[model samples]
Target: MKYSTVLSLTAVITGYVLADTPATCSTTGDNTPIKSGCCPRDPSKRLRRSAREIFARTDSPTCPTPKFYGDSCCTHEFAKPTLDKGTFNLQCGANGVADIVNDAVKVEIVGCDTADDLTKETCILQISSTPAGSITDTHLEISTSAWTSTKYPTKDPASWSYTSYCVKTTGVCQVPLNKIGDGASALCDKKLYIAYHTSTSDGTTSKTCTGDGTLIPGQPGSRWWEYLTLDFTCPKTCDGWCCCEKPVTPPPPPPSTQVCNIGTAFGYADGAKNLNGNPVGPAVCDTANRWGWYFATSETSLSGTLIVGAGGNDLTKGTTVGTWSATITGSDITFKYDLYDDNTNGHFDLSSVHVYASCTAPTTCAPGKFTFKDDTLTGSSDTSYTKTFSVSGGTCSTYYLIFHASVNQQIPSTGTCPTPAQ
Candidate 1:
């Protein structure tokens, strides 16, 4: 007898049998009921898939769907506000409100040359959240020692808001400190942390919880300012290399002077000392105590007066007393002497006068009767005698003269002495 048997192909693969249906087992053999499992169509082509696959997606989706990489992709783009990455401290400037990029924060500082109370100043604030809040506005104020916060819902004023209680602490509090906003007033000089949180209208909240960007006095020409609404401006500076420096002026050198003396020892005369136009000293045979003669000084040619016997008494015309004079020319020295008395006592008359010149001292060291053969002064018209000498500054020496007297003719009533030629 032949027996017919049936088995589920997915359950027992050894019971493999050929059928006309797919792996879903839709077909049955010879009037058999189809409610049970059936054989697959191609028993050798491939195994059939069942409805109970473990890793496949089913009627329900996964809790968190995979991030979309499909056409359902979205893009929300916004240019960031102009950010100042440098010091947040605003430099000194004309007083006014200063707004950071896009009104992110409004820092109003009572600015002026006369600012004293900082409490009256706008707290330096930088909020990276929704600039404006609707339906409610929350404020967190930090001061040097304490902090206060006030919350108001939509259409509610902060002053009349329901949240009236403010907690004060000696230190700063982090953002969302179980509060909408929290911060502390930091000393301008001291950098402090301030954080803010603003609830979004879309059931989202914004945070601006970090700012050591302390506000400070602006400096001229520094890059410490962004959009300044001040009446004043801080100076700006740029990187540059020094090109030139100022040159120093030097002082002038001192002047140089050369001097030449008059007279020798004993019968010595000092032309610099004997000059009468500027008489600060007396003249006599007084060389031991003071020089009595004057010296002639000239850078090129000699030109000055010198006297001998400056202490001698005066005499009548045509007679030599002792006081004598010499006027200097290029190379010549003219000498003249007067008498001791002309009061008719005719006490004395000069027989001759001597003038001397030397490149070195003494022309011959002799104290007795020095002579250089000076011209006689015998006249009633001009009693002053004039002469000339040639003396270079440092080269060539000087000499002195003495006068000798005896009886002489009466004064010439008419004829005057010849004017010496230079």
Candidate 2:
């Protein structure tokens, strides 16, 4: 009995020590290797394991059999991915006076499918939304991927252009929803359609629907969920910038008026006039009230002048013209020229002096005969003489002004030389 008890105690102690031994990698777990240990530690010595692994442990694509070196892992491999995706429609409307654009639905995705799986490969879920028909507007802009309406008489959205925002391969993701605080990243208006795609580890899967209307060129994956237009509050009317609400109608514009500007102008006078009704006083100082100025337009075929302005003064300080203006309002034109000199009424007769002028565009000037303003004679400020005339313009876009003064000179025609005393 004593020998048996001693043997039992030794056996119990041996069994406890064996049970407490440091663990060695086995083919069952992460069948891997270590440099050296109490016994041999080699993956080759491990038993084969059939643990058919998928997007295992890390949710990352891993080899069906992962081997760890005392660590239980080595080798890079891609595991199959299972995708779950959702899509939605575009929603838009008005809140009081402001407008709102919304995603009726969005691309719903649970990219990493397995529990405790972080190693699942990354992929993209693209959703595209577009209108069903063509629309034209002089007040707003609309396209396959964009639409906007502002105001008119400003920048008409008619000419605004854009390219489609498609063909994206982005991988970032979230379980986004268009809830209270959540909003859509894109918008679609009018008769609309939507579609989506879920890419896999190696390539892309088929389409998974989230909204229903008409899915154009539908893409298919072995797995998908379609959310077609179930129930919706279709807009009653379109607004100026929106496809819903009462459409804003623009009023008709008013008629335009005719207008023109001055091109060039001038005036001059050169001839002798009698003073005190007598040609004897210094032979009627040779000169006119206004002369030597030209008014010409840019054209010759037209009859109306370009309302020219002119000013002139003699180098000898004998005469000066201040404030000369020629203007045309509607079909009536008026020319006013003021002459100043020390010889106010000094060498000019009271009656016969007449001013004749005409304006022709492009080439010549027509003649218009008229008398000076009888009310504009003044002895103040060195003989001030002001004359104004009104003329008609025929349909010419351009005109020229030509004038001259030639008081009965020498009379080489009918009058005798030095006046015949007979």
Candidate 3:
């Protein structure tokens, strides 16, 4: 948006009269009254003409005044008819008064004479609200957005000597409804003043009138033709710069769907038990790389299917083949399982290694899906192993775990696996 310097209008002359009493003189002679110029009787009314058009038509030395407002053709040499109340309307959208309160409406003033080239000049348009008999007045500034070049009084359409400006109230403009009247009601029924002025325009050299177009009484360079006063009434409610009622706000969004807490231990379900008779547990010994008995604790209940790759076969194929149990607390989970070796005639290496969980059944534990895995027990007869998982979430429920094992599984010195209930 562009902002320019503003020129203020002063010494406002209020009250509006469309035309003078009809002249009874003839149309062809110089006997026409000097104040009310000569005109043909019964002149047609021209509604909503621009100020420039009204000035030019009334000053024309013709029988029929083209843009006169009433039957009498009053020459505007002394006074030009100011814009009436219906000439301009405030365009508050379909919401009407509600739009004004919300500051969603813009007041546009078009066809305002700027008197000079826009690129070399600055123009100002102002609107003020004053009560009928009150001295308080509030002025609002409007910014110019467009310009047109045209002749003012000449009938030739090709002439471009004078500049006209188009302006509108902007987004940053707000109506102070509380400052207008008594500040207790919703209706802003007050006298409105609309004025337009250019920073460098001279009033005396621009037009041929004395009353509305002449210089203001005390202001040396100010013009009276630049202002139009009328009645302004609307429904609005505001306290200071804010509307009395607030605008409606929109609603918020929904929650997320992730199920895993990524840094805590995965716990066991209620009533989980270990079947092996080693003893209730947390039996500690050397790590799996040394020669010693280490009883893995059976704390967590296995709720999902366990796929064990024992002796080059899936030991999880039958429910009667093996029994497994596990429990987790804090950052550690201990598990142990016992599986019968099907190859009884020949000795085979127990190479069982990794454990994993998934939402569905799988033939092999994939790379990214391994929940608990250890490579130290491969090709060995170690009975106990321990590893830690880093994922955090609710306890295991409605899922499957894949466990790989080998033949001739070594048991702890006491038993194959520990029973946590014992």
Candidate 4:
């Protein structure tokens, strides 16, 4: 049977079929319908409906109807407010934090039919700061009530209406000082989540999106689409907290070029009589009952060796204080000294303290071989003394500091001395 004859029989049976009528359809003998259904004229072609066409029609159409078999497709687009590609700048506030200037937060939106529909939608602007090496972050919402809408239905590129919100002008907005940071020219990580929703009961306001691209906890609906995260480096200079000026960093104060010319070492006596006044034989030079002198270098690690040369009429056995090596030129050097009384009596009767320096190690106490650096009298009430001398070429290098204490009193007849009264 012909295809047209079959389609005519099916169309007559059913009343609601939107597909185009084909030229013919197959039929059986005696004018009875031979085929169960009628297909489109071009089986490969399908019907596609755009948003405009779908909105224009009142009835909803489905594909593959009983009378004719074909594909029907319709597309519905969702709208959300997006940040305009226009300028967005940050300014310094009076509180020394970053703030949004007037009209700085610009949002462009479309697909709103009436002013009431506009009320159902809102765009959010958030400013936040996550300090360096900190996991915690703070957020602040700018005023969206000040958002003023201007429709440009016939714009050059495409039709889009923009809603701009001025932050400083409206009383609703304030500088988010904590979010923008507190110090001078503080840095803030700004996240502007322009969330726009269409549900009237959703109650989605500018606070709905807190710059994290997620709705407020437990709040319903996921219709928000547009989100923009801007990481703008705040400038050092801001014009009343509005526009960003280029940041200028003074070239790190030209690396300290001036080197230390002279190195100084200070020697401090523990007390008038060291060893806690504990009495012992003057010949005893053990760790206990000895006068210790603490030494430290002025210029960080002044490379040198300290030698406690024996002085006085009876003391002879010299001891090495310590040797210091510096990795960096101007490092600090320090050592300790234990002036033990090797004499028979425990009396540390000294005459004078002498500090000498030499480029090379010397065994004998010759004034000509070692250069005399400084001297301090033991009879003085001062318990501290300092030795200032020039280093080799004013650079941190190897040298020797020799300390000699001359004692005038002879050893007592007794083998041990009694502890002095405190």
Name the candidate that leads on lDDT.
Answer: 3
Regions more than 4 Å wrong, model 3: 1-300, 303-322, 330-332, 339-349, 357-364, 386-388, 392-400, 406-422
Candidate 1 accuracy as TM-score? 0.19
Listed per model in order, the count of residue pairs whose N, CA or C atoms clash below 3 Å is: 46, 45, 10, 19
For model 4, the local distance difference test gives: 0.26
Model 1 residue 162 lDDT score: 19
Better by TM-score, candidate 2 or 1: 1
Cα lDDT computed for each candidate against the true fold: 0.27, 0.25, 0.28, 0.26
- Could you tell me how far off, in angstroms, the CA of residue 154 lies in candidate 1 after the best superposition? 99
Deviation in angstroms for 383 in model 1? Answer: 10
Q: RMSD per prediction, one decimal? A: 40.9, 35.0, 28.6, 33.4
Q: Between candidates 2 and 3, which one is better according to lDDT?
A: 3
| Residue ranges of candidate 1 with Cα displaced over 4 Å | 1-323, 344-347, 363-371, 374-422
For candidate 2, the lDDT comes to 0.25
The RMSD (Cα, Å) of candidate 2 is: 35.0
lDDT of 1 at 264: 22
Candidate 1 C-alpha lDDT tens digits along 250-326: 68863332211112211223333332223443333323333223343332223322222234221121212335544
When 3 and 4 are scored with TM-score, the better candidate is 3
- Model 4, range 1-422, lDDT digits (tens) per residue? 10100000000112233334421223211222222122223323212322222111122233334433333222222221222232222221212124223323332222222223323333122222211122121223322221122411121111112222222222112232222223111222222322221111123321211122222222225422222233322211100100111234567653322111111212223121122123432321233424423222333333333223322211233333323332223322232223223333222332344443434433334323334423334441322233444432244344444444433322333434322211
Question: Candidate 3 on 1-422: residue-level lDDT in tens?
Answer: 11211222221222233323333343334444331222222234234333322211322222223333222332332211122232222212223233122211223222222212111212122232211122111223211111212312122211311112222222122233233233212222333332322211132332111101111122223322222233333321110110011123557653322211111111122332221212454312122111111122233444322222221121232222243455454444555654333445211233344555433333332323356655444443343444555322334333344444433333334443322110
